[model samples]
Every structure is written in structure tokens, then in C-alpha cells.
Target: MWFNWLTALTKGVLLMAIQIVTDSTVQLTAEELATLPITVVPLIVRIGNQEYFNDGQDITNTEILTHLINDTELPKTSQPSIGQFLEVFDRLGQNGDSVLCLSLTHFLSGTVNAARQAADMSATDVTVIDSLSIDRGLAFQVITAAKLAKNGAPLEAIIAAVDLHRSHTKIYVFLNTLENLIKGGRLSKAAGGIASLLNIKVMGEVVDGELQVAAKGRGKKFLNKQIDAVIDDIKAVSPAKVGLTHVDNLTTVSEISQRIKAALPETLVTIHEAGPVISTYTGIGALAIEYYTD
Candidate 1:
């Protein structure tokens, strides 16, 4: 009788199913994904005539950075095709599980639209959300939904909370060099050269689905300003999670993470390596911080 009760409990837990789907830009670690019911769809990374997938499992940011440092050419990135999204959706939909797919901002990439197209083709109930942010900012929304889903929350509740989370979440990026932006034709060479010569760092945030400059300064002034902004936000809001991501710049990221934790001792801080899609724009030695309110 006791054995039967334990078996029944296991079956009951298994029935409470919801799946999380996110793109490679979410930048979540392997260990974290193991604990949460999340599946990742990789973006495409191109260098010269070669192409690679930003799948968190096989391709990593470390390898991508190595190529950037050694090669003269800057890497390029693209959103996953609709067919790629369909493959993932069909697999996850096999068990009739409701899926919540979070994607990079529509302004930055067409990943969200691809997800939506796949959702319409999916057999199971699928809700695709435009996170309106990238990197860990996107991860925060996915993490929240996965947690709610694991606790047996209904699909509607999960979607509502995730939608709100994406709006409230904020991401701040610090670029040590403007070489990539200039190379990509997003910034003029003259302006990038001027900024580089002056040792100025660029800081930006994604607002209204667009990248906007939030702050800029040189050396310590720049670092302090960004850190101060984070500290101020924590003081005003109920801090749920903080993420520090860097492009092969762990030392600086660690220092910043320490300062953030020192300010809010109870908050959980996750450090991730920025993947190819983000690195393609930020260039080498870029770092970013993302957080959401409780």
C-alpha cells in the first residue's frame, strides 16, 4: 500500500507539465537548464565562409571569442529559421505539454516572429513572447516562467507573469571598444575612432524594443556610473535576480558582481558568458548586467 502511494505521487508530479523554450541569446548555463524545464534553440553565427550554431551545448562563447581575437574579420549572427523553430516545437509538443517560448527583441532580430510562425504550426498550445531584451534579461523571464510551471501553475498564469517580467526587466551593456559597431556599419568610423582615442566606453539599454544609449564615460567614471545605477535600482525595487555576462572578461564581471551582491546580500547573482549573437555587436571585452524586480 505504501509503495503504491509513492508510485501514484510520482505519476501526479509527472502530469504537471509545462515546457520553456528560448533562443541561444538567453545565455543560460548547462547546469541551470538541467534544473529547469527549458529547451534552447540556437541562432546562426557566421565567420568568413563558415557558419556555426550558437547552441549552448556544442558551440560556446569562449570559442567564438577566440576566433574574434585571432581573426581579422568580425563575426556575423542571424536568427534561427522558422523550420528550426518548428523542429523544436514539434519535439516538445509530443507529450501535449503547453510551451512558453521567449525570444530576443523583435527590433534586434526576427527570432520572435520565427517563434510565432512555428507556434501556429505546432500541435500543442504554444505562446511565443518577445522578451524585448537579450542575454540575461531574456533569461530572467524564461527562468520565472519555468519556476512557475514547475510548481504546477496553469499556462495562462505563466504567460501573464512572463509578459510582465519582460517589461519590468532591464539590461545595461558596457562596451570597451566600438570596433564592432563601426565594422558592422552601425557607427561611423570617425566617431568610433574618436571614442576609442579618448578611451570612452559606451553604455546602452534596450528600450521600446530598440537599443538606446543610457550613459557614457571614460575609465573609472564609466564603470562607477553603471554600478551606481544598479545599486540605486536595487534600493528602490524588490530584487529577484541579477545577472552578469561578459565576452571573455570574467575578472571585470566578477568585480562588478561582487559590488552588486555587497549591496543586496540576499539576491542571487548568475554569471554567464555572452554568446555569439550578443558578441557580434558588443565586440571584445564587453560586459553587461541584467536584473528584474521581485
Candidate 2:
């Protein structure tokens, strides 16, 4: 059911049609969305009494950062409802087009589960994929699938290619503050307080669909060393694409981008601001490095 065919009357031919769908956590620009054959379903972010759709257009990351810095209540994010996914799937598959829906890791969110439920309830042939990643890490896979679909590749080939890319992709995050973690109940208040008093920074990696802290140290020197290590690792792999995403941490992210470009001139590098759902958890001054190897 993953593959669907449509008849073309021009030459009496049968052509394969596939549609790419993903949640808004994937870091794609407006231009990319307009140009690519990909559709995004948005998550919801609630701060106090106001609710915002995380589609970038409904609420900008800048506004989210300001609220996080000043608001008393921490922002809350929710996965898109099954009905939302069902609507998208139904529309895309209305004309005999099979749909490929990729979602954020279920470890961090229930988006994949919602997508799966919607896929089952819909009449269309829908395949839901747990990307096992977020942001640019997820975007890389979505873009790859869209490109393959546009070229009329078979469903199996698209899935295999996406799997290969996912295997080679790596995500590393540096948390400049532990306040969000503590507020979100991910870290104990006592532990976060101690770390904050010592001005500690946390370096984490996304592995097996979960974030695991890899290192912790104090001051700018420690942060620099970790960034250097990440850069060195990227150099070792000679990645095909490097994406830098952050929540209002432009200076540091820009520096890392320059270093990557200098070292890997052939690689494609992109810079994006972390969206609301991501910003809510990352807090201010958080940077994420997404690397995809050849």
C-alpha cells in the first residue's frame, strides 16, 4: 500500500505518485516548503493563556525566546492531534497518491504515535516513519525523501535511502543553561541549582532516539573545547551536510559555521533558528549541531 499509481492520459501511461509529510519540528524555510513537494503539520505551543501553532508563521521563535526569558510560566508543547494528521493524509492521498509521513522521535514526543493512529484511520495508503530525530536532523531525511519522490522513485527505495541517511546522521546539543531542564522536570531542582551556581554547561548527544548528556564542565573554555571536539569529529567524517540550529545563540553558532565551512569547503552548511517547540525545551542560548555523513 505504500506505492500508488495514477493514470496519465497524455500518453496512456501509469505514473507513481508519492507525497511527503512531516511535523513542523523539521527545520525547513518557507522557500524550501514552497519549492519542495513536502507538507508540514504543526504542533501546538501554549504559554499562559495563549496558544500558538508552531508553524513559524503563527508564532516566531523570537517571540518565543522573549516569552521564555520573561514569562513566569514555562511554555508547554503538544503533539498534533490524530485528526490533524488524518486530514493531511486524506487530502494528499485523495488523488491516488501514497503518503509518507515522518515524525519526531517518540522518545521526546508522541507525534509518531499520533501519526500512526491517523494513518490507520485514514482511507488512503499512508506510511508513518519515526525519524528518530528532530530539527535539521529530521529535515535532512525529509528533504531526501521529497527529492526521491519527485523523481518517481519506488516506495521501498525511498524508505531505504531515508534509513541510510538517518543512520549516518548525528545530532549534538550544547545547553548554556539548565533552567529549562529543571523547569521541564527533566533535571532535579537541586541538581540544576548546583550546576547553575557553578556556571556549568552541558553537552548532549541524540543517540537511539534519546538525548544523553555526554559531558559537563564550567566556563567558556570548556564550551570551546567541546565545540572543537565536535568540529574535529565532523572533520573526521567529512559530512555531506552540516546544520547549525540555535535558540538566540547567533554568535556561537555563526563561529561554528565558519569553522565547518573552512574545514569542509565541499559540504553544504545551513543555519536555522530553533522553532518554538524546540526553543521551549532548549531555552535560551542553546546550540545544536546536525551532521550528516556521506
* Model 1 lowest lDDT segment of ten: 1-10
Cα lDDT tens digits, model 2, 78-121, are 99999999999999988999999999888788999999999999
Clashing pairs in 1: none
Q: In model 1, where do residues sit more than 4 Å from their true spots?
A: 1-16, 185-199, 235-238
TM-score of each: 0.85, 0.92
Give candidate 2 regions above 4 Å deviation.
Answer: 1-13, 185-199
Model 1: per-residue Cα lDDT over 1-294, one tens digit each: 212334645677555378899998886767779999999999998888888888754567778878888988788878899999998888888877878898988877889999999899888678888888888888888888888777767777777788788778888878876767767654566545566566588787778656666666788677667867776886577477888988888998898778777877888888988887788888888888888885
**lDDT of residue 33 for candidate 2:** 89
Please state the error at residue 101 of candidate 2 in Å: 0.6
Candidate 1: residue 6 Cα off by (Å): 20
